[model samples]
Each structure stands twice: as structure tokens, then as C-alpha cells.
Target: MGIFKKPPLRGGKRNAGVPDDLWTKCQCGELIHTLDLKQHAYVCAHCNHHFLLPGRDRIELLTDAGSFEEMDHGLYSANPLGFANYERKTADLREKTGLNDAVISGRATIDSFPVTLAVMDFKYFAGSMGSVVGEKITRAIETATREKRAVIIVSASSGARMQEGMLSLMQMAKTCGALSRHQEAALPYISILTHPTTGGVTASFATIGDINLAEPGCMIGFAGPRVIKETTHQDLPKGFQTAEFMVEHGLVDAIVDRTKMRTKLAELLSYLMPQPSLSGQETLG
Candidate 1:
């Protein structure tokens, strides 16, 4: 047989795509280096579009260094509805995202304040709120209640996982129920809404936070604009179902930037949660 060689990649030196491990485009047509994106917390410096952030990275961004101790790390999804290839698909996602489920629940400190943190990974099946995800979140909230720690849930999801049927939908109520108890104990819960928070998540624990915060331009609603328009035969208003609009209308507490999220959370925690006294004489009152 004659010796042959494989063809070289496009552009002579690299792949043809924009973000070929080197470059990406902003919404304003600005060329951004992939390294620049990481340095900027994945926010576009030109137009400031908030990009999808990975769950583990978000945990690192929000939590104190060496402070994250993950809980329920071994839990995986089960095919309660017997969806074809669901287990196989979930296993693949587990390997791909390096997460046991869509949500990563752990005990972490933000600015040295203890918190129960749960971050959802959108790369895993759109971060669907399936059985395991629901269980993990509920357990996180319950643990926070027990520890008298603040609960911070960063929600990014497509809503209930249809593959699990009613089992998935039940999570909406289950998480909320746990949260209701958490609230009764007077603990603070800060829900961070990233891009594309909708469906049951928007209607449930995600929205009922003591202070609901969202990133700029995050899409938040029960149903997306297109789905609502198609179902109701109505024209959606400008900027409808967005974090910007929600803040203006008082649905969301504030539209926070990704860069300032930790600072804002720490500030808010200072206000909502009382810090422990440092000196013994302070109790003289």
C-alpha cells in the first residue's frame, strides 16, 4: 500500500471555527481571546453578555479557597420512568461534566461566612431538575437549616426533567417544602439566577429566595417568551422575561454582574445574617 497522510486542519495552522481553543466573538462583533474570557469570568468585555459558566468553576468563584467540602458526591440519577437509554445517557453526562448529577451540593464559605452551596451545571442535559438534582438540593437546604447556615443556590436549568415524569415535577414542591422550613428557622437563602432559569425552577425555590439575584440579561420565567407567545397568541413585550426586566418590575431583587456577585452576596449576607460577636464585652447590653 502507498503511504498517505491525513489532511491538515483548516486556516493552515488551526481549526476553522472562531473559538478554536484560541478565539471567540462577542455579541458586539468584538474578537475575544479564550483566555480573556476566563480572566473576565466569561463575560464579554465589549457588550457584557453573560456567558454560561460551569458549575465547578462557579463554586470556585463564589467559595473561599480550600473551603468547599462537597456533600452527596456519590449520588447518581435513576431511570424511574424507564426512559430508553436514560441511564446510559446520564452515565455519559456524569463522565462529561465530572458531576454526580446536574447539581453539585456542598458546604462552603463565601468571604468566610459559612453557607450551603448548590450549583447547577447547564452542560449536563441543560441542567434539568431530575430526581437526583432535586434530592441533592433538598438535602443541601435541609443541612443548611440544621447547621444554621445560609443557603445559596445557584440555579441554571431547563426545568423539570420530562424523562422522569411526575418524579421530576415533584422536585419543584419538594425543594420548596424544604426551603419553606429553612425560611421558618429565619435563615437567609440567596438564590442566584444565571442565564436561562425558567419552568418549575423559576416558579419554585429559585424565586422564593430571601433575596433573589440574577446576572445581567438572564432569561427568567415560567415559560420562555417563545413558548408563551405560541401558547397565548400574544406579542411579548420588549425585554420580556429577562433579568433586566424582572428587576425593573420587582420580580428579581437586583441584576448583579458576575464579577460583583461575591461582593454583593457578602454585603447582603452581612445585612441579612448577623455575624458572631468577636469580643465578650459586647454582650454587656
Candidate 2:
């Protein structure tokens, strides 16, 4: 009989399944490689840590499969002040991140509970809040209110955009105003703080959630640790403004891992907006 050669295995690259190159130790410590990090829902596998995710990814993770419908997709920024390099910067960021602005606003369902989602994309100019971002978010809030759906704002921003000057700063108040309206309507607004959520974004609606949640190990504060330390000339507290710290300080309602976030959010929404009790109505008779 002629010698029979073994056929190749059904699955190619057995070792490829292993994520050996999916982690790297950075000066800040071990950071998971981006692809592997994403697979783990932006959580660091090395330390069981959570990293900041882009706006698009956050929406995808939070929303039910194929349930998201984006709102305010036509918005774009114009060079009103003619700030130096502003146009170039915006174009560069858009090209790099494939996003028009720092924030993405949309409607989606979390475990069948309707919700409005606004997620900040740090990849776009460090997810800086500007007039456009503020407008989009405000529109989202209004839509949610009209639709009677809960609102979820996921923040991962550097701060206010400087190129827009005071205009960017005004966004702080504008976004807060929109969130305030939602509060007045007794609508639930949940803020999920991701890594490095700071500055105007943090000072405004990011911290204004009726129920605030944060990913594990996320930096949640108004300012960066370095700036604070330099300004105060003192050593900051251990774990400083991390999500764990915020939870301990009662700043955040819970420190949930990405894996559990969707389920937890859905449960919370259910409690806050339960279906009308037909059983109770029948019993009342």
C-alpha cells in the first residue's frame, strides 16, 4: 500500500488561538495588546483591569444585538473662529478614528429596555467636548425624553476642546442642562465612567447620572492625577480617583466589570421602570 500522508487539521494555526502577544508591559504597568484587550471587552487580562473603550465599541457592548439606531448622524463642525490647525486636527482625527466628532449619540435596547446612549470617543481629539458634541448629546437627551426611554452616557474624554475656545467650555453647561431636563422628567440617566474620564465632561453630565457606574480600574475624576499632584504639591491618596476609589467614596453606585455591565444595567432599569402590573390591577378589583 502507498504511504498515506496525514491531511492538515481542520482548524489552522493551533497556537494562533493563544494570546501570547496580546499583552505588553507599559510604563504605567502591563497593558494588554489592543486586539486582545478588545476581545476581553477592553479589560486588561493581565491584571483583571478595565481599559477605556472608544465610543463605538461602548455602544456595541451595551446595546442588544442589532438594536441600536444612531441619531444625529448629519452633524459636523465648521471653522467659526478659524483657530490655527483646528481644521487639520479635526480632519486628522476623523481619518484616524473614522468618527466625525468625539461623541456618538444613539438609541438602543439594553436587555429589551429602551435607552438612549451617548458615548465619548477618546480617539477623536482625546474625546474632547465641543459645541457639536454638546448639541448631539442634548438632542439625544431630548429624543430619549420624548421616547420615554432611559439614557446612558459613557464618558472617556480628555477635557473641553481648546481649539473652540470658550465655545467648548459652554458645552459643559449645555450638556448639564439637557441632563437636568431628563432628571426633571424623572427619567433615569446612567453614567458609565471609563478610564481617564476627566475635566469638563466629568464635571458635567458624566457625574450627573441618577445611577453612576464605572468600569474596574477606570480613572474617574475632574482632573488628571499628575496635574492635581503638581498643583497641590502633595502625594495623592492611594488608588486616587480610580473607579474602585469612587465606589468607596460613594461617587459611583457600582464598580462593575464590562462582562457584567449589560446585565446589571438591564436589571437596574427594570427596577426603575418596571412593566405595568396587570396582576395588581386585576387584584384591585
Candidate 3:
């Protein structure tokens, strides 16, 4: 008989003095402490997997401390089509997430460069865009236009909310219309496409950025690959919907490392901002 029976350790229990919730296993099979993972901006150091950032976290990561001034609050979706149990589900999510909708729109300074920011919260119903999400984004863009500042929208969504029916689908046109005016004003509209930015959102304003940037390994597509495969009955190209793929195919402009995004945005904004015209020296037609 063994002198001591060994306790069977499984899953994260393999480590001692580490709480299960404080640690998570990455897709690359590396076990990382949550604090350390957070320190790395939730990227898997081993495989460079970019974990999705929540809307609020994204705002903090991109904007200067205390520089964000939020607008368009308390706009929640109603049961426009009266989808069964949708109101109950939305109410539950609102209570859980403390957000009235899937997107947070406001003004903030990125590296002291003024911008109107709208970050989509995937935790809220997969970051689905319904009436409120569309309205908030439209308002944000219009506000930026009036203020003569740049616009930045970080998208992390599966698609439009199904419960709202046509109302949800209509956001595609509404947001695009707002962006058209912003473009006409010569103000930059930067769209940061994150993991799983797909469906109607992709087909709309997500891909029309003046400078569209995406995170490494983000999935940007109108439909899931599986559905495309099933529909076409053809062998799919490897990693066809990834951010890298999108860049190669001209869908995305560039892929930025999550950690470097703030610096990059500042640099871009600096370059995009009109030069002072050599200290009042002016000429031209």
C-alpha cells in the first residue's frame, strides 16, 4: 500500500496556491494568471492570440485618463417587434452589464488628440447592433462632425440583433449615412476592427473607415466561414476571414498590435491633422 494516497489533480487544480478564477488557460495551452494576462492586454503571449476587450476597457486603454466625456446615455432598446423573451433578456443584460445598449459613444482624447469614440461591447448580446446602437453611433459621428474632431469606433460584434427585426438591419444604412457626411468634411473616421467583427456590421460602417485598422488575428467577415463553406460546398482558404487575411485582400488597411494601438492612433492623428502651414506662410490655389 502507498504510504499516502495522492489527490487527483485535474484542470487548473494542477497548480497550488492559485485560485481557479484568477487563472485561465489560453488557446495555446499556456496557463496564465489573470493579473498577468491583464498585464499583457489579454493577449496570449505564446500564440499572439488577441482576446476581445470589453467596451469600457477599450475606452480606458485608448483614451487619456479622465479625458472621456460620454454622450447619449440611457438609450435602451424596446420590443420593437416584440420578439419572445427579448425584453426580459435585454433587461437582464442591462442589469448585469450596467449598459443601456451594446455600444458606448462619447468624446475622448487619444494621446491628447481629440476624437469621438464609440466602442462596442460584445458582452452585451454579442455586441449586436440594434436601433439604439445605431442611433448612438450616428449621434456620435454627427457630434464629431459638428465639433470638427476625428471619429473612432472599435467594433467587436457578431452582427445585428435579431430580435429587433428590420429595425436592427436599418442601422446599416443609418450609420453609413452619418459617416458619409463625416468623410465629406475631410475629418478622419478610424475604425478598429477587433475579434469576431462580422455580419451586418462588417457590411456597413466597419469596413468604410478612412483608415481601417484591425487587431492581429481578428475575424472580419460578413458571414461565418462555416456558413460560407456550407453554402458554397467548396474547400475554404486557410485563415480566410482573419485580420491578416483581410489586410492581404484589401478589406483592412493594417493590423496593429493591441499594445501599440494607442501610440499608433496618436501618430496617425498627428499626421492626419492639418499642418500649421509653416507658421502662417500661405500660398496656393
A best-first ranking of the candidates according to their TM-score comes to 1, 3, 2
Deviation (Å) of 10 in candidate 3: 10
Which model, 1 or 3, shows the larger lDDT?
3
Best by TM-score: 1
Candidate 3 per-residue C-alpha lDDT over 1-285 given as tens digits, one digit per residue, 9 for 90 to 100: 564675555665557785658978888899888888888888888998888777887888899998898998889999988799999999999999999989999988787667899999899999999999999999999988887778999999989988998999999999999999999989999999998899999999999999999999888999888899999999999989999999989989999999899999999998886543453313211
Q: In order, what lDDT does every prediction score?
A: 0.88, 0.82, 0.89
Sorted on lDDT, highest at the top, how do the candidates line up? 3, 1, 2
- Writing each residue's lDDT as its tens digit, candidate 2 over 1-285 gives 334666665757777877775665644587557677778787666677665576777878888998888988768777778998888888887788889898899988787777889888888888888889989989989888877788998888888888888888998998888888888888888998887899888898898888999887888888788889999999998999988888889989898888888989988998876553544223111
Off by over 4 Å in 1: 1-19, 277-285
Worst 10 residues of 2 by lDDT: 276-285
TM-scores of the models, in the order given:
0.90, 0.84, 0.89
lDDT of 1 by residue, 1-285 (tens): 334565544557464455456877777888888889989899998898988998988988898888899999998888977899999998998888888788999988777677899999899989899889999999999998988789999999999999999999999999999999999999999999998898888888889998999999989998877778999998989989899899989988998899999999889888877774465213211
Can you tell me which runs of candidate 2 are displaced by over 4 Å? 1-35, 276-285
Q: Assess candidate 3 and give its TM-score to the true structure.
A: 0.89
